[model samples]
Target chain A: MTELLARLPETTAAHLGLSLAALTLGVAVAVPLGVMAARQPRLAGPLVGVASVLQTIPGLALLAFMVPVLAALGLTSIGVLPALLGLFLYSLLPVLRNTITGLAGVDPAVREAALGVGMTPRESLVQAELPLALPVILAGIRISATWTVGTATLATPVGAPSLGSYIFGGLQTRNYAAVLVGCAASAVLALMIDGLLRALALGLERRRRRVTTASLAGLLGLGAIGASPAVCTLGTRDEAPIVIGAKTFSESQILAQVLAGRITEQTGDAVRTVDSLGSTVVFDALEHGQIDAYVDYSGTLWTTVLGRGEPRPGRTELLDEVGRALAEERGVHVVAALGFENTWVLAMPRAQAERLSVRRLGDLAPHAPRLRMGGDYEIFQRAEWAALVTAYDLRFAEQRTLDPSLMYEAVRSGQVDLVAGLSTDGRLAALDLVVLEDDRAVMPPYDAVILASERLRRERPDVIAAMRRLAGTIDDATMRELNRRVTEAGESPAAAAAWFLGRPLPP
Target chain B: MIRLIDVTRRFGDRLAVDRVSLDVAEGESLVLIGGSGSGKTTTCKMINRLVEPSAGRVLVDGQDVAHQSGPRLRRRIGYVFQRLGLFPHMTVAENIGVTPRLLGWDADRVRVRVRELLELVELDADAVAERRPDSLSGGQAQRVAVARALAAAPPVLLMDEPFGALDPLTRERLQGSFERIRRELRLTVVFVTHDMIEAMRLGDRIAVMSDGRLVQVGTARQLYEAPVDATVRELFAAPRRQARLIESRLERGAP
Candidate 1:
């Protein structure tokens, strides 16, 4: 219990730091921007219009959007900055709008009186205007703080550590305890910050002044002190199936969903992942024994997933070689590769490529550094990309790695000169990012494979066979268009998966 | 010494204060008396430039009020009000210290000044300095308001009916206090009020107005003794006498 409590503080600190930083950063950017806008009426409307538009974008899409942008900038830390940027954007309206509203609402008489007193504009604002406007300004701060804390929970998707981890991870793995802890802690944090700030507001009103923000600091400190007693008891239960987990892309989620889904279906037993796992988090969880099994790609297994050295080989031979090596090396098993090839193919704008006379990977090597490269999340970071770059000496002025769904748009928008896109993703055709042939053969086959904990093979061969039913059946053309409809056409992945399994297309 | 030269203040076509000229010499207290909407308040406010005249100019000690900007101008001119618009945020001392602080008085000077002003207003400085405006009594707040206006010893004080809201007893007490303060400070005061008795008691000189136009201007005795027109005779000094007679002798006759 003491150990658990100790860990709890660190966890809570992480959440608070992320949430507060998000709130502060949001206020820092938005208030000044809003002030500028309000002063220039023409600017204020459109500036806020842009912020409101940001809020209108879905939370998941926005976080996903930050992944490649931040990753390209080399900011792939598994915590606050990613989440903070998103929450900061989320917190803008309350602070920005309220600041403008509060300051604007000050009576004209008071402003004139302040000015009349020979106060410099800055002095007048502090002594006369802001004092009168304090109640309203404090109101904005309270709202922004509460909002940032709440929204930062969603950062768990992009490998951020927060309360949402419990909810999403628990949902994935069926671990209600971890979910309960995550949720309960976050609620307390939001409530605590809200209460303390409210007290400060009330105290200032009656006394007509403020002291140090000690009241808020005290609560945050107390929360830390209170969190110290729970860390030890949860002691590296990291070995339990409930402990280790991973989140890759949709395929990883679907594979985890299918495995966990069928495990409960057949045996009437449930084990939930403690937190929702993202791409890097899944590997970390595997290394920490924080999760038991996850489904990743064979080519990813060769390059990124396993961090293997590059080799010159064909699709089938390379996959086989990588699969054999991983079993020998990592003490992990490839139960099966789903009936599909999730290969990374460099795509270009069809018309643009034709016009440029660029036909293949080697054909465009000279222009590589000058062109823009767009690809999926893992592909840009993979050895396959490096080998392709090294083999063809490919370089581009800009490189963008995006979600498989957005690969086409990156090319469509002319934002990228080349895209390392999935061979089977349907978005390639829909958005017109043409697949340039990899004539140099530097890339390997990426068969969708379900890698599991060795403990699982000794225990559950039935689960393996059930998953193998999906092995090597989904072909490039059939799978490509299906994936496109789900991502690009906005259909559900579960519905898409159901349709894929309904066919006898797998060999 | 505050003077308004042919001041015409118009609010979107209605002449709030028409081209009226008035002068308040140093050490002289002038009272502007009229019913509401007669521009009594507007004329006093013009001396401070609170209400800018649509045409014409006001001068304080020969310096144009329009040109005298910033704390230098404000520090030299004090303003009081009937309701005593004391800021709710600051304590009594802080409110009283506004003008001094604005004039860049040192902290020690402000302390001493605030203490002396509180003493002059008959408030215990120590008790009131830490207390907020809302916590102070109405009479107390008003005294603090007077102290605030007098803090920097502005040569000219424009008061808009400073005692209009007080009870008659409190009004009489404050009037006595003001007379003493006026002699010691030698301030050029412009007081606005509708109460004829208050004007007679407080003002050395009186200016009466009707419909945004000045009807009469003279010493209080001169206005009362001569009363150039029937309106002046009926309105200025008779209202109080009528109230007294009607309440006593006429009460039994009416019954």
Candidate 2:
């Protein structure tokens, strides 16, 4: 436990506690909403359904969705806006359900007597109904508290690191102990909440037994003494929040650093990041409010955003409309597309490419029947890859999508003949794989677009400006270097972002 | 004064109260004497608007009570059901202060009034006031209910078998306290009871009913002296005769 505590940042633990603090807030929100919904059965149907739906959305998807949505609205980790919002929405069902159930379960005669003695609906609720309902409501809160603590740990992946840093740090290093520590800490926090809330519920239960004010006061004093440690502080006066988010790949991390650096120039506020989520996840994050801003590829927005399986439109038209379509439908603003497209670029040994004369997909088609293809897992299923293969009608000897990390070994050992490398990948140069050019430009340009949540757009003009400054700045070489620092240099994201932010990209 | 006029209550197809009416004059304790389902509790609830009349109006101070909202109406009409319904969350004094507190009485005034009501119910003012309803005996809790009912000094009070749960000794003691307090307050009270002896002991005037209809209305002495019908006469005579029968049954074939 001591080693675990020592490894985890105090900053991370503090955010974890504060974010879960919203469990109480969620209970406060849920109880009244639940009560109102209960009183009017018609409202309960839709309102309760909404809370359930919110919980069903996967945590990663929801966090990514909220990022740009909040960036547009200009809220972040500093405001605790998205974290509070997501947790609140998540916690509503249990507290609300319990409140309604508890109130419904109270003896009718007791309720009647309360009303019969001049208790207004409000007074009757506070004096009679709420006291009775508290135990049930608190039980629901216990569930939400456990769930919220568990989910908030994922906030670390999205620049909202609470205790989740331990889990992610473990994932990065393949150390299960780190994940266990995170889970254990969260469970401990949840147990603490359960104990305190149960004590509160029991004290309220025992309130009648201690009729004297002095006894009640003593109980309250003891509770106050007990609660002081669990409270987690949020926001420093000096470092304000600049919101940043990232797409799935390495280059997106570089762009996030670019944005984070630019924002620091304006307000001297430290950036809050939700980084390295899936392409779709990042898009949704911006839409909901988890991330303030993130980088995305033009090709992804074309097919993924438009909901088309194969790329129907050509490269330039797709790129042009990508911005317009995302803004119109998703409320995502694509400020500017950067210079490079990290599109699928098939490569192999230089001798192999030359001997086959495989300059393009069509050029490689005749030889493909005998060649085995190896690439990242996602490229095989991507629309760009699918369309190119179908267009050329090339059938390789065998196609295998390997993890990007294992690609060099797979190619060097001749486990596969061809490499489906990304255009800006540093490994293509480092491993000396021949990058076969796509003569037909079949793959749409995978350019970066700056996104903002509607909240961030209305609220933080400075953050948008800081990110807009990064538009047209990153090219293939610059981003490759940024990735090299992160992957090869063994530098952490914060240090990597700091170094990259200090050094301006060449125009 | 409390008055019910031509009240008729229906529970599904059953006639719980069928055009029955009566008056509870100030300083007069009027208990409705009835069997189960004879509309005695229904009539009492109508005064505080707990159970609304299906057909006629109840009047308190000759003003229509049906128009008063539940909370506003109940404060002026003190009511205690057969089950007591003392808030399990509150102490005896706190339960007593419920009405006065709802009426916006200051803390000091409400506390003083609560103490007086507990004393009126023959409770030790200091000792019993802070005790929880759960901790109290059935009889003591019933007394607390009576104290709570009279806390705001409502001129019109209604009770549905308030001492119905207690044992004989505690029930009689509470009945005596209520009688003496009723004398001192000169309050209009509508009490419900199926117990003929209890009705005779507590009521100045007794309204006897059967099958939801009023069979007779008269002073306690008049009820025993001359009832309106055979059923009314039997209702008055049965309790006194039952006591004698029980006494005889206990002595039957004994040494």
Candidate 3:
């Protein structure tokens, strides 16, 4: 709990920075566009239509889409940039629509009176039309602000640190307290921002200068404080920080911390981790030099990166081919294999497996017609699952996609008869589940290998050397124990990683 | 001070005002009396270039109105709308000072002018200057609107039924106040209204319009005694008939 609280300041600052920057930019772009549209009826339809279309896209998909869209434009594709762009786009519809509506709703007589009183078109707008429309425009901004704060929680998956990091990391590790804290904090932040803006609108409507000044100050002051961390870092840092990437699971998070610890110890370089990234996003980020290093499995590279579907190679051959293909074609360096294979394994409750006599993949074929199966979100979509189905001719009565953390509990509690789980997942032993043997050797090797970007290898070879020291350091038993400490004993990934390195916890 | 020579206006295919010509001398009050769509309002608007002429020319102070920008030309001409279009967002003082401020008068000058105009319109400067238009009664709001028009002290004033929205008592009171201000300032006035009695009461000369054309322009007595057409005669008949009805009622009550 104390550790989670310690992370609160940094995460809250990141969340505020992303939301406020996006909202400020959103207002800068949207207000003028809205005014132009309000004047030119021909433009009003298309401008508002485009913003409305953007609003229809689901928020998470919008953030994820920025990754590739920005990459194609040769811009920053990960971290805060993509997240900020996505949030800015989301904030446009409300502000733009309200600006147009508010101006259109102004009394025509009042408008004519402005001209009658010798006001120029420009003066009429700035002095009369805008002042009258202010309350409505402020209402739109309030809606946009609250929505931006709430949606910023989704930025974690795109490699931006936010309050969402707590939710994503906590859910994967079964730390409910962290999730509760993230949810409650974000709700409070949204409410406070909303309340302050409402006060500003009321002040403007009632023409209270003191109330307006105070509320406006409160709003900008909060934004500045939230954005200060990012500003300070940009001002002070002389060299770019080395960014480590991690997938959205406890094991990957631990491995990333392990890499971060080793690099910092040996090279004394500034290290930052962008965690909770999707599998494909992490690989694409590394390929584009958005991240310096991450841990990936050999089987993922062979199937997903190499696009190989047939003729599974020997374990050693598979690792060598993956390394060669990555280095030659993608300019990625294979730093080291961590000497543990966390491959896909079919698991069932021990008592259930014993009762059903399902000792091997081949043995499951007869019972598959009656049993229900479950797997993590990605397993049912992978090539290895297809290979197993064809090799064993297995057809389950029902198959469910579950979170990686929850699948063990699902099978143990009899919600599923079988689950395709990682071999090194500590829950396999902790819950007394038996692994069904791949008697035909249909599955490919999944040796954990460290991969570094081409830029990192060239520019920071010492950092790469520091990472190479981790070669064959963590065997299957040791890796399983590290996972056990997080999944069962409720330890954080950083604590488990520190234990492995034989060092005290950081801070 | 104001001249419209063969001035015409068209809203797309519809001719709102056609080839109407008139002139107002300096310090003269000319009232335009006509029913709805009779082009009286459109003719008045052309003097300030609020509605551009589709044909012919409009001249103010012997200079063609089109020669200057609309805002610059409008700054030199005072106008009051039929609806008394006071800016709801501005205080009474701000609304009155709008024209002077737009004419680039300094802050102290605008402030002094606002107070003087408020006094000229018989409004309490301290009580009403800081209040918004929404807070004022019908008579007070109408006074503020007139004060706003007279702020920059333009030579020409165009009023389009300025008291049409007020109750009869309020309208009468405002009309009296306006006549006093107009004479005191010697403003060249072109007032538009549908009320024949009001035209007779306030206008030095009344111009009657029908179907976007000026049918007659003369003093009230000249038009009443020698009307050119049935439209001008019918405009005069309403007031004459009302006078007879009231006279008969007074005679029967004499006992």
Candidate 4:
């Protein structure tokens, strides 16, 4: 929890920076467009329609969509740019709608008085209409601010460091304290912003100069404090730190910290970890040089990256094939296999397995007709699931998809008879679940391998050499123990990684 | 100082004002009296170009209004709306100083001018100058509107029922003060109102309008002696009947 609190300053700053920048951009674009729409009856409908439509696209998908959009434009797809752009787009609707509505709601008599009093149309808008409409516009800005702050948490998956890091990482590791910190901090930030803006609106409406100035000062001061960390980091460092990527799970997070520790120790280079990335996003980020390196499974590379199906090769041959294909096709270099396979395994509660006499995958076929199964959301959609079904001809009475974290509890509580679980998940032992053997040897190898971007290998061969020392060091038992320390014991991934490296955890 | 030559205004297919020709000499007051939709307001607005003439031309100080931008022309002509139209967001002083400020007057000059105008309208400058329009009573707001119109000291003033929303007593008090201000300033005025009594009291020459055309233009006695039509006679009939009722009540010693 202390470690999580220590991370708050940086993550909160990044979250604030992204949200404020987006809102500022939103105001810049939306206000003028709203004014134009309010004046032009023909334009009002289409202008608001476009913004309303943009808002309807789910926020996370909108953020993810910017990755490809920016990449196509030859701009950086990951990190702050794409996340900021996505948030800016999301903020447009509220501000634009309010601007039009506020202006439209102005008394026609007041508007006429503006013009009648010798103000040009521009002067009327600037001096009279806008000022009168300010309270409503400020209300819209407040809404946009809170919404932007909350949605910014989703920016973590796109490699933008935000308070979302705590929530996503904490959820994967069952560290609710970190998640609570993230949620509470962002909620407080949103409320603080909303309150300041509300005060500003009231001051403007009531024409109280002192209240207006104070609230304005508070808002600007908050923005500057939030933006200071980003501003200070600019142009200060001689070299960019090596970025280590991690997917949204305990094993990936642990392996990432391990790799980060090893590379920093051996190369004496600064390193930063971008954690809680989606599985495919991490790989794509590595390929595009958005990250330096991450740990990936050989089977994931073989099936998802190589786009192969049906044929299952030998374990060693599959590793070589995946490594060669990635290097040739996508410029992602497979450095070394980290001697543990976090493969997909069918597991059942020990007592249930014993009662059903389901000791192997083949043994499950007879009892499968009466049994219900559960797995993580992606398991049923994965290529391995197809291979298993084809090999065993296994059909369950009912199938349910669960989050990987919740799957163990679901099976333990008898919500489902069986679950396709990860081989190295600590909960397997904690919950006393038995793994059903793949007697036919149909499941492909999922050896954990270190993957590096072409840019990293070309620029720093020493980092690669350091990472190679990790190969064959961690076996199945050691990897499972690391996972258990994180998921069950509530230890952080960094601390578990530190334990594995035989170093005292950082204070 | 203000002239409307065959000024015609149409909103889409509906003719709001048709061939309305009128002129106010320097330092003269002309009231345009009509029922609602009778184009008295439209004729008044055409002088300031708030509503442009669909045909013909409006002139102020011998220059065609169409030659100048609407705002530039308006800056030289004072206008007060029927709704009083005080800016709710601005203080009374700010509302009054709008025209002078827009005309590029310095802060000190505009501030001095705002106080003088507020005093000219019989309002306490110190007490009301910093207060917002919403804080004012109906009579005070009406006075502020009048003060705002006279702030820039334009040669021509167009008032569209400036005290229309005020109660009877407040309207009468504002009308009396406005009459004194008009004569004191010797301002050329074009006033629109539906009340025949207000027209008789305020207008040097009353122009009665009906159905988008001028029915008669004359002094109250001249119109009373020679009615152009039933509409013109009916406008005078309401005031005459009210006077008769009040005179008979006083004769009977009623309160």
Candidate 5:
């Protein structure tokens, strides 16, 4: 709870910046287009059809899709730009639809009156029809304002910071307090925005000066709050700080902090972190130079990227093979191994394991049919899961994909007999779970390696060299302790990384 | 003066106004009397270029209406619709002041004109100027609509059933007010109405239309005494008989 409060200012800024920017831009564009659509009957169907189609895309997928699409356009694929664009697209539908509806809904007699009063079409729209339709259009804006706030939370997974950081980070670390804080803040923000818009709508409807003044004042105050962070970010665009990314996990976040801290310390260069990226997104962003560097597990890249199902004889051999493959094929240079392995592992509660006498993966086959296995959403789709299932000949009665945060609790509470656990997860030790050994070596070494974009390698070799100072610096216990600080002690990854590096905390 | 030369307006395949030709003299109140769909409203609209004629020309003051921009031509001609389409979002004063302001009148001058029009329409300017249309009575709203149409003091006016939506008592009162105002302003007006009684009461000359063509154009007494056809005679027959019966009763000193 304290951690969430401490981080409130930055996250609140991000949440407001991205959501409000998108909304304002959305209205600016959609309203005029809507008016044009209303005027031009020939274009009305296509205009509305396109906006409706955009609305049908799921919010998360929409944000995710922006990363690569922006990259393809040779633009920044991470940070607030892509997020803003995605939310803008999402915010467009209601405003456009409502503008069209409200304008169309104006009484024909009233329109005649406008024309009869000698108002040009433009003047009629500006002075009479728009004012009359203000309430309805504002109602649409209010809907979009609330929706944008909620959808902005999904921006975190696309390398944009928002209130979703608390939710995504807290969920990954099993810290529900942070999630509650984020959800509550977003709901309050949404309500505040909606209330102001409602006031503006009422003012327009009744043409009351006092109501208009109060609502405009309220909206202006929020506008300042929302615009502040965005202004700051855009002002720094010329500097273009190196963007470091992390996937949605405590270790990933901690590793990103370590890299950022090291680069700042050694090279004295400006660095920015865009954390909570999805696994594939971070890699794609790096390749496109939207992000300069991020830490990835070798086994994950080998299987997911290379489509190689075969496991090598040893950890070093696998690492060497994958590292060479990445550099040769994709222009991604492996800076160094961070000397920690966070591989996938199967685990059960100690009591359940003892009761079933399950000491290894082979020993679980007999009981697998009666058991329900739980894992994170990606586990079922991974090659590691397939390899493990084939090696052990194991099939649970049901395989449920739970969030990473809930898997431990599910296994601990006897809701599930088994789970796919991360090797370095703090909860694996905290919950007294027994990890089954893989005798067949079906899973390859999952050494965490720092990978840099080819552009970064070519342009900033000094930064890479500085980052290599941390090669073999963190061992298994050290990595686990860092994770524990974030997941259990409520320490932010920045603070944990600073503590581990014996340096002052970031301002 | 306004003239429709072979003016024909078609909405799709249906001819709303078919080859109608008429010349309205200066300061003449030409009431277009017709049943529903009789093209009276279409003819009125053509004067302001609200609806362009498909096959002919509308001339205002010896100039082609199409030569001037639609909005510019409309600003020179006042238009009042049946429903009294006063802008609900604006106050009565603002509604009345709209065209004068559009003509670039200063605030003080626009305010004075709004007050003058309000009085001309028999409305209390002080009481109703700040009130919105929704707050006004139907008769009051119709008055404001007239005031709005008269704001810029256009020489030409086009009214389509301006008092059609009012109660009989209110309608008669408003008609009397309009008659006095029309005479005072010496305005050239093409007033459209379906009611023969209204046409007789308000029009200097009434142009009656049936279907999409002009049936007869004459004064009330002229049309009453000399019937163009039975339809035109039938239109005024009942009212003429009622008036004569009432006159006979008065002459005999009967209550």
Candidate 6:
């Protein structure tokens, strides 16, 4: 809580900048396009139709899709640029639709009057038509202002810092306070901005110089602040903070925080985190130099990246081979192999496991046909699942794919008798689940290792050295405890990491 | 002086003004009178190039209206519409000053002319100059529209049912004020209306139109006394007959 309060100013700037810049750009582009569309009715439908389609896309998908689209266009693929582009696209519909509708709604009689009074088409539009349409257009701007504030939070997953950072991090770690703070702050910011827009409309309508000037000044001030490069660049600093990335999961978030905390403590260099990335996006980001480092499991690198179909070797042999392959193939460096594995494990409620006397996969085979199984959505789709089913010759009565965050609760409530779970999930301990042995070793070793891009290894040896110190420090128990502090006790990952390192929290 | 030399206007396939030709002597008030869609408004618009003729030409002061750009020609000719189009966003002063400002008159001159026009239209310059259209009554807005049209002191004026939306009392008062302004300024005017009484009261010569064609052009007394056809006589009497019919029907229903 204290950490969040202390960092409030930076968070507020990021949240405001991304959202406000998007809206400013949206209005700038859309208003002129809307005027053209209004003048040329033939083009209005296609222009508005495209914006409508953009608005219909899911917010997170729209933001994430910008990564590759921008890369192809030779633009920045991550952080504030892509986030702003996504937001600007989303903000178009309301303003564009309203401008068209407002222009159309002006009295035809009044238009004839303007023409009769010798107003050029241009003069009529500027002096009479737009002013009459002001109220409606202003309403549209108000809708967009509030909407962008809330949607800006989703930018975090795309490596942009926003208030959504707090909410997404808190949701993963199950911290309700941080989530509440994020939601409240954004809502309040939206209301304040919306009120200012309303004042602008009133000023225009009533011709009140003071109200109009103040309102315009306020909006321009926000736009100016948002336009400045310092506010618009997410997770960037003058000293160029070492950016750490994490995937969209609780353990990944905690590990990223641990790395950032450790790096900042040891070197006194600034560290910025761009967490909540997509599963494979972190690797892609690192390859493209969008991020400096992140942790990855060897099994993920082996199957997803390398496309190897052979049975896995021992953990030590697998790590060396994977490390060598990554270096040769993608120019990524295996900075250190954190000495803990997070392989897949089949788990069930302890009472249920005891009742069925299922201590191993072979033991569970007889009871499989009578049991309903549950697992994270990806686990059901992975090669490990197919291998285990084939080796054990097991079949469940039903199998459900659920979010990993809810898998423990689903098993605890007997919604499913079994779940494929991660070996190091804090929920496994907190929820008192028993792990069944994988005697056939169908699942591959997944040693959590810190990986860096080749650029980071060659150019910033000091950072790699600091990162290398964490290689063997976090064993299974220590990793489990660190995860527990976040997932069970609702402690922030930075605090847990700080405590583990016996150092003060990084500013 | 304005001359419509066989001017014809078409909106798609329908001819709004078909082969209509007329002349307004300098300082003459020529009222084009007809029922709705009779092309009176279209003919009035043609004088100022608001509606360009599909065939033939309209000449203003010996120059073809088409020779000048639409905006340039319109700036020299005053026009008033039925809806007033008073520019609700601007103050009465701003609305009156629009044409003069467009003409590039000095700001000081424009301010003085705006005040003069406001008073010329019988509105108090101090009380009404800063007020917007919405704050004014319909009659006041109509007057401001006239003042705006007259701002550049254009020699020729085109008005299409300028007082059509006002109440009868306000309409009559505005018509009297317009009559005085016309005589005082010695302006050449072409007024369009469906109202027979307004044409008789204000026009120096009335041109009666029917079915996009002018049926007669003469003084109001001459047209009222002589019958061009059943349509022209019916046009003049249609109002009184309709009113009597409605009154009789209402009295019968009351019993």
Per DockQ, the best of the predicted structures is: 4
> Once superposed on the true structure, which residue ranges of model 5 sit more than 4 Å away at CA?
A1-4, A231-242, A264-271, A310-314, A354-357, A362-369, A386-395, A502-507, B241-255
- The docking quality of candidate 3, as DockQ, is 0.75
**Candidate 2 local lDDT, A1-507, one digit each (tens):** 345467465634455554556675787788879889767879877987888888899875566566566676755522245555666677677787787788887778788888778788889888887777777887887777677767776565455546666665544323456668877877776676566556666766776344434444643543453243344323342354445776435557667776776777876777766554555655666776656777777777777667655435666677778777777888877766666667768889877778887766668888888999887757777777778888788789998876565665688788899888777777677677888777776777777677777787788777777667776676777767666665455555456667767775566
Cα deviation of B86, candidate 3, in Å: 1.4
Residues forming the 10-long window of minimal summed lDDT in candidate 2 chain A = A229-238
Residue A426, model 3: lDDT of: 94
lDDT of 6 by residue, A154-270 (tens): 998898878887887777777768889889888988987898999999998888889999999988787665556454452356565588999877788778888888788778988
DockQ, all models = 0.21, 0.51, 0.75, 0.77, 0.74, 0.64
Cα error, candidate 5, residue B161 (Å): 0.8
Interface RMSD of 2: 1.2
- Residue A235 of model 2: what lDDT? 33
Indicate the worst ten consecutive residues by lDDT in candidate 3 chain A.
A498-507
Model 3, range B1-255, lDDT digits (tens) per residue? 888999999989988898898999999999999999999999999899888899999989999998999998898899999888899989999999998988889999999999999999998899999999999998899899889998899989999999888888888888898889889999999999999978988999999998898999999889989999999999889888999999998989955
Per-residue lDDT tens digits for candidate 4, residues A351-383, read 988888889999988888899999886789888
Q: Taking the tens digit of each residue's C-alpha lDDT, what string does model 6 give over B22-126?
A: 989999999998889999988888887778889989999999988888888888889888778777778889888888887889999999998888889999998
Task: For all candidates in order, state the fraction of native interface contacts they contain.
Answer: 0.33, 0.65, 0.74, 0.85, 0.78, 0.70
lDDT tens digits, residue span A1-507, model 3 = 799999798788878888889999999999999999999989999999999999999898899899989888988799889999999999999999999999998899999889988899999999999999998999999999999999999999999888999888888898889989998888888888899999999888889999899999988987987888788778865564798999998899999999999999999887888899988888889989999999999999999877887787899998998999999998998999998999999989888889988899999998998999999978889988998999999999999998777777788789999899989999999998899999999999899999999999998889999999898888899899999999889998989999999843234
Best by lDDT: 3
| Model 1 Cα interface RMS deviation (Å) | 2.8
Off by over 4 Å in 3: A235-240, A350-377, A380-402, A406-418, A437-443, A503-507, B246-255
Looking at model 6, how many pairs of residues clash? 0
Which 10-residue window in model 6 chain B sums to the lowest lDDT? Answer: B231-240
The TM-score measured for candidate 2 stands at 0.73
lDDT against the true structure, per candidate, is 0.70, 0.73, 0.91, 0.89, 0.89, 0.86
Q: Give the TM-score of each candidate.
A: 0.62, 0.73, 0.94, 0.94, 0.93, 0.90
* Model 3 alpha-carbon miss at residue B126, Å: 0.8
lDDT (10s digit) by residue, model 2, range B1-255: 777889999999999989987877777888888888887888778778788899998888888986767788888878887888888878888899998988889999998888778778888888888878889888888888888888888887888888887898988988888888888998888889988889889988889888889888998778767877888888756777888888898889545
Per-candidate clashes come to: 36, 35, 0, 0, 0, 0
